[model samples]
Target: MAWHKKPKTNLTKLRIVRMIVQIIMFFLLNLVFFEIGANWLVLPINMPQTIFSSSEGSFFLLQRMLSRAIIPLIPLASFLIIGGIFGRLFCAWGCPFGLFQDIIGLITSWVKKYEPTHSTNNSMRQIGELITGGTLLISTFIGISVGLGNQADVEAAFGSFFEQPWAVLSPAVFLFTAIPVIVYWGVLGELFRIENLGSIDILLWIRLAIFIGAIIMIIYIPRGWCRWICPVGIIMGRLGEHSLIGVGRNITKCNHCGICEDVCPMGVQILSHPAERVRSVHCTNCLDCIPACDEDAMELKIL
Candidate 1:
C-alpha cells in the first residue's frame, strides 16, 4: 500500500515580504504624520495640526496636487479617474489606520469565541459616511473662516461643551495610542505602560468613559469603531471607491465558494451580484480574502 503524503502548508516568503513592507510603511507614515503635528516637540510648523480635523492648516497631501498652473486638471481628475480604474489596494496594503485595525482585530480574535456579525444595510453605512463628510466639510469651512480672520463660532464651539474635543475624539492619537495605555495603567495593571505614561490633557471621567467603551466594543465587534464610526474610515471609504489601486477578480478562476465572504473583516458579500467585482465602499481593502480563496482568482492591480 502506498502511503499518502500530507501536504505541508508554510507561509510563503513572499507573504513575509509583504508583511514586512506593511509594517515598515505603517510606522514610516505614522512618523511622518506625527512629525508634521509638531516640530522637535518645541517649535510647530504651519502644516495641519491633525490629519482629520478642520484645524488651521490641514490638507490632504494628495489633494494638494489639484491646482497647478501647468497641471490644473490633475488633482480632481486623478481622484475620480484613478480609483474606479484600479481597485482599492492602497487602503489594504498601505493605510496605517487599516494596519492598526488589523492589529486590534487580531488581539480581539484570540479572546473571541464566535465571529461577530452586523447589519450590512447601506443606510447605516450611508449615515456614517454623511456624518464623516459633514464633519470634513464643516472643518474646511472653519479653515477658510480662520484663514479669512473670522473666529467667532470657532471660539464659541471650542469653549462650549466641545472643549478640546479634537484631542479626546481623535482616532489617530487617542483611540489607537492614548486610550490603551491609560486603560492598562488604570485598570488592567502597569503591563501596557512601560514608563511614566504621559498625562492626558483630557478630563479623567471622559478618558475613563472612552477606555471602558473601547473595551466593550472590541469584545463585542471586530473593529466596531473603525468600521462604523471612524471619521477617517468614512473619508477613506469615499476615496477607496475610486482608488487607483485595487483587488481584481478573475471570474474564470473563481468558483463562488463564498470563502472570501466569510473571511472579510468588514462582512462584505464577496459572492454577490457585483459579478467579478467587489466595489464595497465599506471595504478597508485588507487583502484577507486573497489568501482564503482556494483558486488564484484575485490579484492586486493598478488601474
Candidate 2:
C-alpha cells in the first residue's frame, strides 16, 4: 500500500504536455456542455456516452450494438484502426477516466503509490483480459438470445447486465452516465422509499461500491484500474500490442537507473523491454518515462 523507497524524479515536460492533452480530450469527448446530439464517432478511449451524448468509446458501443443484434461494423473498425495507430495511447491521453487518475496520481505523488514488480504486474493483467472477453461473450450471448426471441428469458437472467456486463458496474460509466441520469431523474426519491427498503435495487448500491472501490485503489496504487481491470484497455492491448507508436529506450545513453520504471504509473519495466521499443500490452504510450530519465535514455519510437 505504500512505496517505502524509490528514486526521486522531477515533474517532467512530457508529463505536463500529457496532462494538457488529457484536459483537451476530456472536454472534447464529453461534449456535455455543448450537447452536440447523438453521433457515431467511436474511438478507443474510456469515455461513457448516454443516449443524448455525442461520443462513446468503442468498447461500450460494441456491447450495445451486439446486444441489439447489430454487427457493429463501425465500432469494430474504430477499435482496430485506432488501436493499430495509437495502441493504448487513447487510454493515456484521451480517456476522461485517465485524466481523473492523472489528477489523483499528481496529488499522491508526494507519498508515492506502491509499485509492483514487473512479474507480478504482468500476472495481474490477465484479469483485464478475462473481463474484456467475458463481457464480450455475455454481449454475444444476449445477442443470440434476443435473435432467438428469448427476450423474457434474457431479462430474467441478466436484468441490467444484459446489454453491458462489466459496464453495469463500470466505474467510469457510473461516474459519467449513471450518476447524472440518477440526479436528473430524481432517483434519490426512490432510494429510500422512506417506508420500504425492499423496493431498492441492490445493484445501485453495488454499482456505487464498485465506483468507489476503483477510486480507492488508484489512491494507493497508480493506474490500478487501468493495469488490473479495464476491459477497454485489454481490448486495445490485444489489438495494438505491437503498435507502431510507442515508448523506446535509448540503450546507448541508458545507465539502468530505474527512474523511468519508478515514474511509470503502469509499472512497465523499461530496462527489460527491448531497446528499440516497449511492446508490453500494459504500456499505454503515456511517455511519462521520457523526462524521468536524466541520462536522456527514453524517447518515443515510430515504426
Candidate 3:
C-alpha cells in the first residue's frame, strides 16, 4: 500500500491571523489610552510610539553632554531585541500601517493585477533608502541644534523649526490622528453635541496627501512604504540583518520551483540556495513563502 503525504500546515493562515490580531490591537492602542505604569505606557507596541522619536532621541543624546534617562531607551531597546530575534515580523504582523498596505493590496488586486518588475522593485528600494536617510539627517541636525545642548528649547524652537514634520510624513500619524479627527468632527459632528472641532488646516491637507499617496503606492506595489520609505523599517532591517530566527528551506524536498520568490512581497530571492537559512534583511517572516511551496520545503526555524 502506498503511504499518502499529510497536508502541510497553511502558514499564510497564520499571517492572516496575525494581521487580524494586529488590526484589533492597532485600533485599541489609539482609541483606548490606558496607562500601565506612571509613564502612561501608550500601547505596548513599538512602531506607534518609538518610530517617530527614536532617531531624534539618539541624535539628541549624541549632541548633549548631559546624562540621559533610561526611560527613553526602553522603546528602542525593545524594538532592537525583537527585531534581532524575529527578523521584522512586527512589520508584517503588528504594524498598523503595514496592515493598511495589505488591505490596499487586496482591494487593488480585485480591480487589476499589479506585479512589480525587478527593476521597479530596485528603484523603489533605492527611493525608500533615500527617504530614510533624509529623515535621519534632518532629525539628527534638529536634535543636535534644538533638541540638545545649552541652546535646547524643543517646546519653543523645535516646533517652529520642524513644524510637526513627523506627523505630516507618517502614514501612521494620518491614520491615528487625522482620520480620527475627521471622523469625529466631520462624521460624528451632527450626531454628537459638540462645537468647534476646528477646520482642517494646510498641515492636515499635507497629511491627507501623504496618506493617499501611500495607499496608491501600496495598491500598485505590495508593501511599498515598507520597501521604500519607512525610516522605522530601515532601522529594523539593519538590526535584523543577523536575526537568530528565520525561514529555512529543505533541500531534499525543494523542487527548484520559483513560487516562493514570486510570492515574496519584499522581493527576496529565497530559492537562491537549495537549502539554507534565509538571512535576507528584507525578509519580514510573514511566512507567505511557506504556503507557496507545494513540496513542504520552506519552514520557519530558530537558531
Among all windows of 10 consecutive residues in model 1, the one with the lowest summed lDDT is 39-48
Q: All predictions: root-mean-square deviation over Cα?
A: 8.3, 3.2, 6.4
lDDT of 1 by residue, 94-203 (tens): 54554555576556765753344445435556655765565445555555554566566664664422222333443444554555555655853553354624553345
lDDT tens digits by residue: candidate 2, 172-224: 89988887887888976776577756766788779888988888888888888
- Residue 114 of model 3: what lDDT? 64
Q: How accurate is candidate 3 locally (lDDT)?
A: 0.61
Residue lDDT tens for model 3, 1-303: 111122235655665676787787565544434422222332112333332222222222221222221233554555567777886777777666777777877677655546666567557677667765665455556545543553445435555325333444677666755566657668555533445325545565676688899888787778878877775666667666678888889989998777778767788778763367887657788888888788889998886
Minimal lDDT window, size 10, model 2? 1-10
Which candidate leads the pack in lDDT?
A: 2
Candidate 3 lDDT at 66 equals 20
Deviation of model 2 at 271, angstroms: 1.2
Instruction: Name the regions of candidate 2 deviating beyond 4 angstroms.
Output: 1-11, 108-112, 185-198
* TM-score versus the correct structure, for each prediction: 0.63, 0.89, 0.75
Best by TM-score: 2
Q: Pairs clashing in candidate 2?
A: none
lDDT of 2 at 43: 82
**Which residue segments of model 1 deviate by more than 4 Å?**
1-19, 30-90, 113-118, 121-123, 144-148, 160-167, 175-204
Clashing residue pairs, backbone N/CA/C < 3 A, model 3: 128-228
